[model samples]
Every structure is written in structure tokens, then in C-alpha cells.
Target: MEEGRSSKGGVKKEYKGGITPFVVGVSIVAATGGLVFGYDNGIAGGVTSMDPFLRKFFRATYRKMHQEEARSSAYCKFNSQILTTFTSSLYIAGLIASMVASPLTRLYGRKPSILVGGLSVLVGAAINGGALNVGMLIAGRIMLGIGIGFADQAVPLYLSEMAPKQIRGALNMGFQLFVSVGGLSASLTNYGTDKIQNWGWRLSLALAAVPAGILTLGSLWLPETPNSLMETQGPEKARAMLQRIRGTLDVEEELSDMMEATKTSEMVKHPLYNMLQRKYRPQLVMAVAIPMFQQLTGINAIVFYAPVLFRTIGFQTNASLMSAVILGVVGLAATVVSMIAVDRYGRRLLFLQGGLQMFVCQVIVAIILATKFDSSGDGSISKGYAYLLLVMICIYVVGFAWSWGPLGWLVPSEIFSLEVRSIGQSIVVAVNLLFTFAIAQGFLAMLCHFKYGIFLFFAGWVFLMTLFVYLFLPETKNIGIEEMNSVWTEHWFWKRFVNQEFHIPIGIKTSSNT
Candidate 1:
């Protein structure tokens, strides 16, 4: 690598020391928590139409009802309500867990917080898999929610702190990509088990415990993040950990940057004040607004209730579960595209394009759902509209994965200043969980009343979010965490997103190759 001058009249210093395998390994291990998150969501979403699932909890009777009696239309509607409660129960516990994350992370450090979270997930799985009644199942789902709430915020925060500036976006996106893998695994697992007797859905729910166990065990052996180590053990220990993680002895430059950032460390103790300060107002706005819009896209409603959505669109029980598998694959592939593009094209471009694409998919689906099918007749969708619905749903997932999935996690983690970074993350994560719960729990009600209006509702949000990104959010490609404040302060709205031509170029200090 060599130094040079750019057309913008800035000096450039290149980096030759590459990232080591250990860093990559640790990043993957830390991100496996995301696998548990996805698996949990998929298992709940996929199990709704399983005969075993419906008969076991929804229609099981001490009143002498048999298999044929359990399939009654009245019984089916009641099952929908139970299934909705079962899935939403996880979120209630998750919302509670996320609200308390600041205290948990403060007392235990990142590693232990995640370890406990993983164990909680495994315990929840056991409870859910072995349940013999609806009450027990709801109890288990609540525990699962608590566990996912713990991992949801902690994993991304750890990844964002551990990764180098060169590949930070990729590593963070990897967290989300693995989430899709967990989803894919769940969908395949459900498809494999969909034909079994009453035990099939139980097996699907229990299978996720394997990944949670892996996450717990892997995190136990990993080192604490550099930022956490620096705060607790001082610079020498932090530097040693950084060298080991980065696989380089020449860490003086990054070390200096971290030291300056650490000066704001006091605010972590009193994060609420810092988060509300005048200086941080804009970043806080961006953090809250983006995640809010992300949920408003109805992505979680799709993730947690896709089988139900497809059921309305005319697919049979097992076929709807299989369709979810396809959606999961499409989502995984799109996330890979985001991992590649996030660093190169920047967050703003992806958001701008992804939002518009999602709106297009939603509008087409909405028009067909609104007019083409008779809601009062057979619940099965016509073949023409069903195929169209499937394709559009998959495309909507592509748009979501490329923009909201990774960016929602990455932006909130990166936008805040150091003082409130951790707590700001919890608040943002809590908001996401809260909205997810609201959307998931309330979606069935929305569908009953609004029909295609629900899709139109989400489409309108997409348009608003697209405008929000273009006007308010700045591109945060390779900027240092310490330098994010300057980006928000840029006066010209148009100048905020375009790179190189803008006033303060990304990668910070143009003389340095980060």
C-alpha cells in the first residue's frame, strides 16, 4: 500500500495488514445469536397451519372431541386467536428484556449477557417442545421472547464494536445474513416435519435449541469486545486484545482514535441525559425514525405471520409452510447482496432504492388482494393471484433485506455518540421489539378489517421512509464511530448523502487509510 493525493486534494494512506482468520471467526461466533433470533421467528411463523399444531393446542379436548371434530370452522378461528397469542407472548417477554438490557450489560459485560440470553432461549425451547397444553406453550413462548430480546441487541452491538473500519459494514450485515440462515433452517425443518403426527411442530420448535446451545458455548470462549475491555481493564489489556483480534502489532493509530472516543465514557453511566442533549438530538432522531419505519414496512408481520398471510392468499397448510422457505431463501440472498453493497455504494443509496422497490411490490399485492379474491368464499387464493402474491412477497423481502434488515441494526448502533451508544441501542432495540409485538399481535385484527388496506398502509410508510432517507439521513460508509456527529451537523441536506464531493469525506481524516 502507498500514500497519494486525491482529486479532492486530500492525502491517502493505504492499509496492507489484512484481517486475520481469528477476527472473522469471532465475528461469526458472536453473530450466531442472530441465528437463534431467526429460528425462533420462523418456527412460530411456520407452525401455524401444521395439523399437529392446530389439533394439539387449539382443539385438544377432554370434552371427547376427536380429530374430525377439531377441524370445524369455528374451531379454526379460535385456533387463529390462540396461535396469535402464542406468538405474541414471546414479544411481551422480549419487550421486558430489552428495556432492562442497559442494566444487564452494565453489570455482567457483553459476553455474559449473551451467554445468559442463549441459555434462556434453550430453556424456552424445552418448555415449548414439551408442552402439553396451551397455557404451558404460552409460558414457553414468553421465555423464548425474553431470550431473543437479550441476544437481539447485544450481538449487533458486539459485532459493531469488534469489527475494523475496513469491514465493519460487512461483518454487521453478516449478523443479519445468518439470521436468514436460521430462518431458512426453520422453514426446511418445518417442511420436513409438517407431515408428522402431533409431535412434528414440537420437534421443529425444539430443533432451534441446537443453535442456541452453539451460541452459548461459542460465546463462552470468546474475548470481550475492545471497547468493553478498555473500559474495565485499561489500555494495555485493551491493546493486547485488539492486537490478538486484528492480528497485528501495529495498532498505535487505532489505539489513539479509541482513546479520544473513550473520553466520553462517563456518559455511559448516565446515558439518558446524554441521549437527550442538544448535540445528539439529530442522531437520536435518525436512530428512532429508521427503526420505526423499518417495522412499519410490515416486515415482522410477514416474518412472524407469513403462513397466515399465505393461508389467506389460498395456499393449503403444508404448502404455505414451504412457501415460507422460499421467502427465507430470497431474504438470505438479498442480505448477501446488501453485505456486498453496504460498504461500496453506501447506506443512503440502498435505502433510497429499497424503499421504492418495496412500495412497488406492496402496491401490486394490495390491488390484487383488494379486488381479485372473494374473502367470503373459499379462503384459498386463485392460482393467478396466488403466484403473483408469492412473487411480490419474495420481492418485498429482497427490498427489505437490502435496506431495512441490515441497516436497521447497523444504523442505530453506529449513529449515537459513545456516551449514550449502549443505552441508545437498548432504547432503539426496545422500540423495534415493541413495534414488532404490536404488529405481530395485531396483524390478524388488521387483516380481518382492512384486507388489502393493510398492504396499502405499509406502502404509504415505504414512501415516507424513502423521503426520510433522502432528506435526513447521511451516508455512513466508512466513517469512524467518533466522527458520526460531524455527519449529522452537515448543513446542506443534499450534501449529506453524496460521498467525496461532500465537505467532510468518509473514512475520516482523508490522510489516513482506515
Candidate 2:
């Protein structure tokens, strides 16, 4: 028994290694894309105050009309749509651009692909900041979308590949953390400059370029992924990179294991084709389902329209922006909690707990709105119920941050094997971007048309998500990549409900043929 225990310890020692400084360095550099993603998403809300510049541009381009005529014109009402087009076109472009990530990552390697993404963002930011009209802004946003597409697809994958198995979830989730930070930064910047209308919005939009520049410069110093190095180069170069990354000279066994993993990954047939095949249908379902539910939770509606929602609940403009900042703070805090809890308590537990909490909060908010308990005369809302609505929004944000925000990215990368990971994750992100575009485009209209019914619609969806997660998601606490397929296929209930859960762990011995 002592000898058996000793053998187990030996095996564990082989699995464990020193921290990889290069990996840490590279992850920070790559995560700039996440910052760009967050900044672009959040900046538009604040930029809406640039009505003077927009009006000037509109007046300069078209025939002058009387003040009353301009006030009542269709362009006045649809000015927001023009801005939405500028902003949301990036997401649409991202959705289309993500389709290329699998091949791009394969051809260029993750690092170079990320560099190209950063450059695109920089160019987009410059164009957007210098835009003379809505058309130019839309063009810039399209370029930004291309950047986002590459970063969203590559950064998470790069993080997952470089991370140690034990801490992969936490490290991968760093993307979400940076996203929250970027959002918070944008909020604070906007709030600080709210009094200065001329340059505030442009500065807010351009600030995103700083991170992209830094990341682009920093990428030059980082090492490529060992897997990428091996696949593209040869064994010796791969071994050297592994040594530098792992800070260990004795990487013969580790190198062998990685080579075998890569070879097996290569032998697997066309991943995109396989993803659509029956054999991989379960994984494909999971990839699509998680992101679908993530967007359907209406987090974007709240984030994108927080100030509007707050004002609807009775807050003044200054107060509404302040409340939005508070909401962002709550979201950041909840994400920090998730970062700590995800690895400790595991992914499934958080999803179940967070989904249920979100459902309850949504129901409460919907009920309050539906009953007209807080409505003011003249189509305005009362301020008395602001605290109640704020509390509910905070609760919903917490629920989303702790579960869906990070896990939505983490799970898909883990669920698919390396063979199909690129395509699988791209599909997941594409669906996410698509739904994000759809929701962002239609959310205000839906709210305007359906009133409080929109909240109820989201509430119903949250409840459904809670049921799905409770019944289907699997526990993937400390599983290795090679074991994923067996774990997924063996458990009948897990296989059936895999779409509901984030990551389902499979236990398989690499040495066994079975």
C-alpha cells in the first residue's frame, strides 16, 4: 500500500511543473483584445451625448431645414439607429470574421493572428475617432469587428493552451476579468468627462487604441505556444520553447506527451466537417447552446441600456449614469468572486446557482414593471422604486458575472478536443456575436413595443436556462484534454443534457485502447 501511494505521488510530480513566465507574459499581451472588445462595447453608450457634432455633420451634408422641421424629422428619431449601426455593425462584422479564425489560427499561428487583430483595432479606432459622418464611423466599426473576431477567437484558445491543466479555468477566465476592467474604465472615463461634451466621446472611443498598441508591441517579446511551435516547426524547436516556457531543462517526457497529443490532434479528420457529423454532434450542440443562453439572459440589454433603464426607474441623468457605474462595479465585484469560486466550487455549481438567482431577479423586476407599481404620469417612471430596481439589476449582474460571463468562454474551449477546438470555439463565439448583434439591435425596439413584457420574456428564458443547466451540465473540475471524449460519451444523462452544462469531464487513460 505504501509503494502504491508512492507511485501515485510520482505520477503527480510528473504532471506538476514550475510556473511558466512566458505563458503569463503572453496571456497579458493577448488579453488586450478582450480590453478592446469591452471598450468598444461600452464606449458607445457614453458617445451618444455627441448630438451636437452629429447634428452639425447632418446639417452640413443635407439641405438646411427649419428648427421645428429638424426636430420632427425621421433622422432625429432614428439618430440613435445611425449610432447603433456604427456600433453594431462591428458585431456583425465580427460574426462574419470569426468564421475565418479556425483557418487563420491554423495558418498564421495564434500569436501573429492576435498581432494582426491588434493592428486592425488600432486602425479602426483611428478611423472611428476621425470620422466625419456616420458612414465613416460604420466603416471604422467594421474594421474593429474584424479585429474583435480574431481576438475573441484566438485569445481564449491561446490562454487555454498555455495554461496548466489545474489552473486553466482561472487563467482562461482572465479574458472576462479584463473585459470587466475595460468596461469599468470606460464608464469612469465617460463619467469624468460628461461635463465636457466636445472631445469626451472621441477620447473615450480612442482610449481603446492604447491597449491595442501596448499589446501589439508586447507580442514581439512573447514566445509562441509549444503546441503551435511543434505543429508548425519541428520537435527540437518545440522542445526548446517548452523548456523556456516551463523553466525546466528536463522536458523529454513532457515533450513526448505534447507531441503525441499534437499528432493525435492532426490525425483527427477535418474538424469543421466533424463538428457537423453525428459523432461530434453532442459537442456542437453544447458549443452553440451555452453561448445562446449566455446572450438570451438579457445581460447586454441591461448593460447597453443601463442609464436608460435607470432613468425609466426614476433616476435623473447624472444619477442614472452614477447608477450605471455602480452596476458596473457590482458586475466587476461578482466577476472577481467568480474567478475565485469557479476553480474551488467547480463550474456546474456556479451555473446552477447563478442561473436560478438571475431567474428570480428577472421575475422580480418584470413583476414590478408589469404591475405599473413605479410608473409616473406623462410616460415617465417614478423614483421611489429606483432602489428596488437597482437592487434587482445588481443581483442579475452578479448572477451573470459569476456564471455565464466567464464560463460561456471557458466551457466551449474545454468541451471540444484540440482537433476541433478552433472551429468549435469560433462557432460558439460567432453565435454569441450574432445574438449580441440581434439583441443590441432590437432590444430598445422590443422594450418600446412590448414594454414590461420584454423583461418577462427574458425572465421566462432565464427560468428555462436554470432548468436546462440543472438537468444537463456536467462537472469538469480537474480533467485532462485527452480524457474529454470518453467522459462525455460514457455518461448517458450527461450526454443527453450536455447542451445545458458548460464543461463535461471525461475520464480516459491515454494508454488504453478500449
Candidate 3:
């Protein structure tokens, strides 16, 4: 059994209590990768419109002359395409990297994997800020994507393991909060430097390095997940790390739970491979499908293309940038609200309500766009409609922030057993990253080809997601990890999806009251 403490000096001491602060602090610090992820994505929304910077850095070239003028002008149609491609190709690379993250995490401990990812971001940020050409920028973006892949895979898993049962939902919501903060920071920075486009975009991109550096340096002092340590190292090492992380909590009980969950003692060769077998397929499906559905909602398209979409509604470039900033502010606010509400109301209810809300917003936006409410004689949209579009987009963002933005990470962690948690999360994130890549690559094409139909497509997805949440997802707030395995075992809807039949053992079912 792991070590425990006796009451001393009139204080009731627990084995895990002493280490809790360190665990929480380290987990939050390591999770800054989410911040870097958001910063890289958010910077482009405003930076794309920096005309002076573009003109200064990407000047017209005679070799690409059109009618005796340089055709490679930053505002030229081709240059716009180049910029869009540069902005999105990294997402594609990240999508591919996410697919491998599960296997990588299984092999390397989460802490080291995250450190490597953080270093990659630092490198990518430096390369991107100094890029002399579009090709180099694209390469830098790919590198950043690789870093995100690692963070995306590891951060949630680490948080799930470290957080106490009572606060897991709230703590996981921190990931979404950081993501919003990163977006807000980028928007504010871009807005502040709108007048100095030459240095503004570069500066914003480079700022991503600061968080990456902090996370890398801080992780050195952080303890690995006690579960990982126990399974990979021996119980003695795991106990020491747990004592450091949990402080005065009942370390023996926690260690016993970890041991019970570990598959290493059995004849099974690999825990992840064992999970992929017929027994755990249901958990696997929920894990992968939740994140896949999250991305299919087209959140990334809105995030990455917000400025462009607003521009289409007739706003001037600067106005659109400002509007995008407003959207970021609204998103941040809604996410904060979600962080508070998620633990109180539970994950399933919020998801159902949020999905339905997004559906309504998307449909309304589609209608407005389809009717061309403020288009000029030449079929170009006017600036007046930009305000309406921005409001609707904000509403849509609120819906997403309150639902999938947090629950996407929260639910998967809650649903899967500890044995498959890492691999399951990796797969879930991989699907999300893949769809994100698809949206990033095809958003402009869909916009140009079908015009308002893109919104309609997303609207349908939100509707489906709403239905899925109501049908399959269970409330997981305040539930212990060990108790979660039985939730699906007892529910009829979940039973149909789970491949292996199991009974909810006695003493496992607790009060459903929130």
C-alpha cells in the first residue's frame, strides 16, 4: 500500500493533500500549449488585413509582372490565395500529426512529450516571424502544427489525471479558457498595432514563443502523472510522485485505484492494443466520435475565417478586423460563463442546449446571407450587413463556447476508463484535427462555390450534434473516474453502443443529484 500520514499537532493530514498544489500548478502550466494553439490561430484573423505590412514585406515583383506592373502585390488576388494557403496548411499538418499522437503518448510519458511539443512551437514561432517568403511561412506553420498535435493530445489527459473528481469539469474548462485568452490577447495585440502593420503581425506571431518557453522551462519541475509513473515505473516511484503531487490526501487509496486500473499485471501485452480489441469498442467510439462531431460543427472555419467572412458582408478590412476582435471578446466571455456553468449543470445538458442554440444561429445567418440583405448592384455585399453578421457570429460562438468548446475535452476524459484514456483521447483529438484541416483547406472553396450554403452545411451538423448529445452522452459532473465505467454499463442507450456487456457493480452507483 502507498504511504499515508497520521494526524499530528492537531491537524488531520492526508497522504495526497501535500502534493495537490504542485500537481494543479504544473498541470496548468504545461497546458499553456493550448494557449499557444489559440494564439497561432487567432493572430491570422487580424494580421491578414495589415495592408502596410503586406506591402512593405511582400512587395510586388517584376518577374510576376502583369501588364508591366508587378503582379505579386500583397493585395493582388494571387497573393491573397498564397496567404490563405499559408494560414491553413499548418492545420493540415497538425491533422496528420494528431493521428500519431496516441501512439506516441503511449510510448513516451505525457510530460516529456509535451515538453518536446513546446520546444517545437518555440522553433516554429521564430521561423515564422523571420520568414522571407510564403514557402518559409508555410513550413513554419507546419512546425507549429506539429507542436500543437503533441499539446492537443497530452494536455487534456494530464488534466484529467491530476484534477480531483469534484473539480474535473471545472479544471478541464481551463483549457478552453486559456484558448480564449490566447485569442483575446492576439486580437488586442493586433488591434493595438493596426497602425504599424510592418511589425505588428510579426510581433504577434513571435509572442507565441513566450508561453511555449515558460511551459517548457516550468515542466522540468513538474511531476509526471502519478498513474503514468505507477504503471511505467514501479509503485515506489509512483508513491513518491503521488505524495509530492497530492500532499495530504489518502495516497494509499489513490494508489490502489491506479493499480486496479493498470493492465500491466495481466497477460495483456499492450494496454492500448487491448483496448482496441472488442471489449472496449464502445468507449473508443464515444471518445473518437465526440471530438469528431465537435470539429464537424465548423467552429474552426468560423475562427480562422472570421475576418474574411465579415469582409464578405461588406465591412472594410479594418472594420472587419475590429469586428473579429469583438467576436473574440464575446467568445471569451461565453467561455468564462461555461467554466462556471459546466460543473453546476453537468456536461450533457449544456451540450444539448448549446448545440441547439448554435443550430438556430447558423440557420439565421444562412438566411440573411442567402437573401443578400445588403448587397450592391454589382452583387457585392455592403458594409451595413457586416454588423448583423458579426452579431450572429458572436451568438454562434457563444453557443460553441458554452458547449463543445469545453465538453469536447471534458466528456471524453470522463467517459473512458483509465486504461484507454490516453489512446482514446489521442484518437478523439486526431479526428478533431483532421476535420479542422478539412475545414481550413476547403472553407474558401465552399464559400466561393456555394456562397451562403456553407452556413447551411454547418447548421445541419449542429442539428445532428444536438441529437447525438441528447441520445448518447451522459451527465458526468462530479463523478469519480472509477464510477464512470459503470455509467455506460447501466444505461440502455449506452449499452447498445458498448461492445462488451458488463454489469454496474454494487456500491458503484451514486446519487445523480448535482
Report the Cα RMSD per candidate.
5.0, 5.1, 6.7
Candidate 1: C-alpha RMSD after superposition:
5.0
Backbone clashes per model, in order? 2, 2, 19
TM-score for each model: 0.89, 0.87, 0.86
lDDT of 3 at 228: 75
Put down candidate 1 lDDT per residue, 1-514, tens digits, no spaces: 1232232334433332467888889989989988998898888887876766776676642122234344332113323455688888887788789767766674456787788779999999999899888898888888888888888768887888888767889998887998899988998998889888768988998887988999999989878887777666678887887898778888765665566566657435677766776556676777678778889998988887787678767787778888899999999999999999998999999998999999999999889877776665354457988988999999999999999888988888877665677777777877787888778788877776677788999999999999988878877777656455556545365333334432342234545434
Put down candidate 2 lDDT per residue, 426-461, tens digits, no spaces. Answer: 998899999989888877567656667777888888
Q: Stretches of candidate 2 above 4 Å error?
A: 1-14, 49-80, 250-254, 372-378, 494-514
lDDT string, candidate 3, 1-514, tens digits: 1122111112111223532667668767866767877888788766765665456444442122122244222122222455567678777777667666766665567887788778888998998888777777788888888888888888888888877776678777788888887887777777777766367778877777976787678667667777778667867887787777666535776676577666533344565676776657668777778888888888887777676666556666677677778878888899889988887888888898899889988888888777754332222554556567778889999999888988888788667676677777777777777777777777766776666778889889888888887877667776656446656654656565454323332122224521
- Which number leads on TM-score? 1
Where model 3 places Cα greater than 4 Å from the true spot, the runs are: 1-20, 52-82, 264-273, 372-384, 496-514
